[model samples]
Target: MTGDQTRKLALVRNEVDLSEGDFDPTLLAVRVEEAARRLSIGRTTMYALIRDGAVQTVPIGRSRRVPVQALSDYLAQRMQSRPINAVA
Candidate 1:
């Protein structure tokens, strides 16, 4: 993979769990740039994901904020949805 791809991969592989406060909906919308950085994705890719609905976004005025719990929920759902394989 290319350097940008690798960097993105590294970020994805080392995702941080969001704490209670980080996800409060009452907070102002988070900018796409910061969210992309936190999620380890390029800004364009994050925008694309938002466009395609792979990830969720909350809009406040002219900006967007992803609820912290949504990220945790997304990860948990992905993990749980994976199929188990028998160990040889």
Candidate 2:
């Protein structure tokens, strides 16, 4: 990775460490890898979700970012579709 990329990755890592609950929605978006971290998934899975249109992303120049709302929306959709079990 170039210096800029390295710096961005470091920033992502720091963001991941600082905000354990959720990202700040006031900010536009986070890097794909950072979004993956927030979702507790791997980068490959995040990319696949993006490719499959399961997660929404914004394109800024050559970089793609996942909005904080998109992550929350994706999790909400998953939770809504999940089946709940009841014990007798």
Candidate 3:
């Protein structure tokens, strides 16, 4: 990864570490890269999802952030659309 990418990843890691402690109700959103990490997806894929409206984002200043509820809603929608198959 490039230096910029490394720095972004470190920032995401720090946010995650903070989340492990007491829940911060004020943290309603996260950086796109951090959201991608939470979804176990590539940054590019996350952006695509955002573009396709599969994930919702809010504009904060000049940056766009994905709301925590948006991630949950996306997962819920996916689960409804694609049911798990059971072995016979």
Candidate 4:
């Protein structure tokens, strides 16, 4: 990875904070970059969203994870502006 990519990954790795011994498996988890990539967005945008609370993320150990449901909900919220039955 390039220095920027490594830094982005490390920054993401550090922002996640959690405690205790277990996690809620009912939630879905994905790497920060992967999540942004899925949305056709970039890493910086992902970090910005997390910082701005536009989306929710969960911390698992030293790695940060974006819950699938959270991403889905975010997209749903955005999709509200579109017509429900609009054909593509």
Name the lDDT value of residue 33 in candidate 4. Answer: 70
**Model 3 residue 64 lDDT score:** 94
Instruction: Note the clash tally of each candidate.
Output: 1, 0, 0, 0
Q: Please, what are the lDDT tens digits per residue for candidate 3 over residues 11-69?
A: 54454453333333445788887788778789999999999999999998898999999
Ranking by TM-score: 3, 2, 4, 1
TM-score list, all predictions: 0.51, 0.68, 0.69, 0.59
- Please write out the lDDT profile of model 1 over residues 1-88, one tens digit for every residue: 9986665554443342433224323333355665676666788987887787867888766767766665566667766777666242
Tens-digit lDDT track of model 4 for 1-88: 8986665555444443322322233435777776786677888999999899989998888877998788888899878978989775
CA RMSD, predictions in order: 12.8, 6.8, 8.4, 11.4
Residue pairs with colliding backbones in model 3 are none
> Between the candidate structures 2 and 3, which one is better when assessed by lDDT?
2
Query: Which consecutive 10 residues in model 1 have the weakest lDDT in total?
Result: 19-28
Rank candidates by lDDT, best first: 2, 3, 4, 1
lDDT on C-alpha atoms for all candidate structures: 0.61, 0.79, 0.78, 0.72
Report the lDDT tens digits of candidate 2 across residue range 14-74: 5445346654444568888778988889999999999999999999788888988899999
Candidate 4 clashes between residue pairs 3 or more apart in a chain or in different chains: none
Worst 10 residues of 3 by lDDT: 16-25
What's the true lDDT of residue 66 in model 4? 90
Which candidate gets the maximum TM-score versus the true structure?
3
Q: By TM-score, how accurate is candidate 4?
A: 0.59
